[model samples]
Target: MNEILEQALLYDFYGELLTSHQKEIYEQFILEDLSLGEIAGDAGISRQGVHDLIKRCNRTLQGYEDKLHLVEKFLAIKGKLHDINRILDEYEAAGDNAGKLVADIRKISDEIIEEL
Candidate 1:
């Protein structure tokens, strides 16, 4: 996955675990795509303070991911859904009996849903 996209996903899954101040700084840096100096100016902090806060936020988010693995499971389920879609498309193109394929897809979908 792309680095920024991965960061966004991680933040999406775990950002609420951070304090309000941390969330604000993290959103400025990652979601808003602000430079350190810009964030510092807006937050009334030094550039180095902004940098350290971002680093701390990254570590805190990673810790949540490490404990819960929610992001990993989400990505896996997404890949499985994509694969199922591709299989359905192939079956439609071939005009074949896709009953067995449908059953397998349903099983996989159920497993993913149960994981959540």
Candidate 2:
């Protein structure tokens, strides 16, 4: 996964667990794509403080992921859905293979259900 995308996913899954001030600073750094200096200027903190806060936020979010595995399950389900879509596309292109494609879709769906 891309680093930024992974960060975004971690934040999305566990951000509400963070304090409001942590959320605000993290949003500015990650979602708003602000530089450390920019965030520090806006928050009236030192640049080092902003950098350290962001780093700490990253660790905190990652810790939640380590414990919960929500992000991992989400990504797995997403991949399964993509596989189902691909199978559907193939089924459409190969009308004679409907039975095989349908079976594939059912198998993936079963996996998704089990994960949920």
Candidate 3:
């Protein structure tokens, strides 16, 4: 996965667990795409302070992901859904292969259930 996307996923899954101040700074850095200097200027902190805070937030979010695995499970289920969609599209294009496509959908659905 892309680094930014992974960071966004981690934030989405566990950001509410963070303190409001941490959330604000992290949102500025990651979601708003602000530079450290920019965040520091806005927050009235040193650039190094902004950088360290962002790093700490990253570690904290990653720790949550490590313990919960919500992000991992979400990505897996999303991929499975995408696979099922592709199979459905293929089934539409190959009308004669309806049985096979139905079986594929069933298999993916079972995997999704197991994941949950």
lDDT of 3 by residue, 1-116 (tens): 99999999999999999999999999998999999999999999999999999999999999999999999989887787878777777776687657875777767776776655
RMSD of candidate 2 to the true fold?
4.4
lDDT of 1 at 16: 85
Residue-wise lDDT of candidate 2 within 1-82, one digit each (tens)? 9989999999999999999999999999889999999999999999999999999999999999999999998998788787
TM-score per candidate: 0.82, 0.83, 0.82
- Residue 1 of model 3 has an lDDT of 96
The per-candidate count of clashes, in order, stands at 0, 0, 0
lDDT of 2 at 44: 99
- Model 2: lDDT equals 0.89
- What is residue 58's positional error in candidate 3, in angstroms? 0.4
Query: How many clashing pairs in candidate 1?
Result: 0
Pick out the ten consecutive residues of candidate 1 with the lowest summed lDDT: 107-116
Score candidate 1 by lDDT: 0.86
